[model samples]
Target: MNTLNEINWFPGHMKKALDQIKERLKTCDGVIEIGDSRAPISSFPTYLDKLVADKAKFYIFSKADLADRNALEKHLDKYTALGINTLALNLTDRRAMQTLINRLSLVRTRQEERFLKLGFPAPSKRFLVLGIPNVGKSTLINSLAKKKKAAVENKPGKTRSESLIKVSDKVFIIDTPGILEPNYEDKNIVIKLAILGSIRNDILPLIPLTDYLLEYLLKHYPQRIYERYHVSLDGNCEEIYLRIAKERNFVSKNQSDSERARSTLLTEFRNGLLGGISLDE
Candidate 1:
């Protein structure tokens, strides 16, 4: 994981995209910042405030369906209390999203009207939906349009370009490619989120991350593991992993323990099979 200051993961294309965002910021009225709900603070780009300096901003905690409801509520409250207009959303909830879209439109309209009275042409009320890779920006676009207007996949870096999608007559979304801060140094937060699938799991080492997640689940979401895999959590993390492996019949014919059990458990937990769990809380 890379920290914002020590980010070494920014590719050439991402640098170009960052340049484009800076250029396009002049034409846009505000920004819609999207982040993973489960790890809101960690997943949010630390440099976003500086990048969008003084711009009207709204925060969307995406994948709210997979987050603890209480945690989500508290996150919303915390952000809102800071005077940031915030929303927690499950991409599948169209009715609730309609309301969100409406609110965004109203905000844009208000901004546009204020600009109009100054005798300048109405600024295009553009919203840049920005987040780290795989934070579900594309899925949010699809959900808002009620169709597949943008490509969406479980993999990271799926949407690698900026796109404009109109959700209503007044609201337009500028979808940017996901950006990763270079070489994040916050190993613990990174590992936790990777296990949650909030970060790209493919790029990370599964065994160590899975081990960390196993320990975490044992302490925080013990019932979730027991309920999902029918494993007793009365033992150590390695024992728990072995129990899950035995239950799922994940074994090597060589009579040795297979690491597949750990991988499977990690994947299931990431995909929310263990329920809507939040790693941070």
Candidate 2:
């Protein structure tokens, strides 16, 4: 993998998005911060610490279906213990989605009470849906609205602007473009995001990322890899890649197609084919 100096993870549009978020946040009642459940801590933007400082905050660990249950529970416990309102949600599940809407409804009620106490008329509760790129921010917005209010895609930077989405008469959310911290310097976090498909694939080489994934699986999820590809996890990542290549018949010009094998491995893991794996652990 290249050094941080060699990569431009924070682009121009992201800076614009951050400015837009700051401008819009003045009117928002609370923040709905979403992050990937598989990597709750790393996926949550560090920049948001100041952005959401005094606001009523609700944290959503999205894509819970793709995360290991034990790891997810640990994260949920940590946040809940901190007195932060949090939920682990599989966005596609209607029951789970309804639960989120219900929680937001409670937020709205509390917001109304606070406003009324201040002698102001109860106003609509506005929330800013914030997170790093492709952590299902738009998908969560669509689910809350009970329709396709925001564009949904598997890749990063799909939503280039912020838009107001009405979930109920009294509850509104702003869907902003996913933005990473401008000075984010964690290479491990970058690798995790790349493996989870939150970062653009071309920004970093896939081989090192795959090696990291293989090492994690070998330590914590060896059974999953063996079950999926019938390849033994008895060797280094290069050897494992070769074994997977030979097993899957990923060959080109009488050589193992390591690139193809790496890409496939990443796709399968991202799509939850290997199992419910969590990178944060």
Give each model a TM-score. Answer: 0.88, 0.94
Instruction: Find the candidate with the highest lDDT and give its number.
Output: 2
lDDT of 1 by residue, 59-111 (tens): 88888878888877877888878977888888767777887887787674456
Candidate 2, residues 1-281, lDDT tens digits: the string is: 55655788888988998899999888897899998999988899767888778777889998899999999998899888997889998876766776777787776445688888999987888899999999988888887778788888999999987788888777788998999876666778888888888889888787788888989888898889999989877767888889899999999999998788889999999999988989987
RMSD of model 1 against the true structure: 3.1
lDDT agreement with native, every candidate = 0.75, 0.86
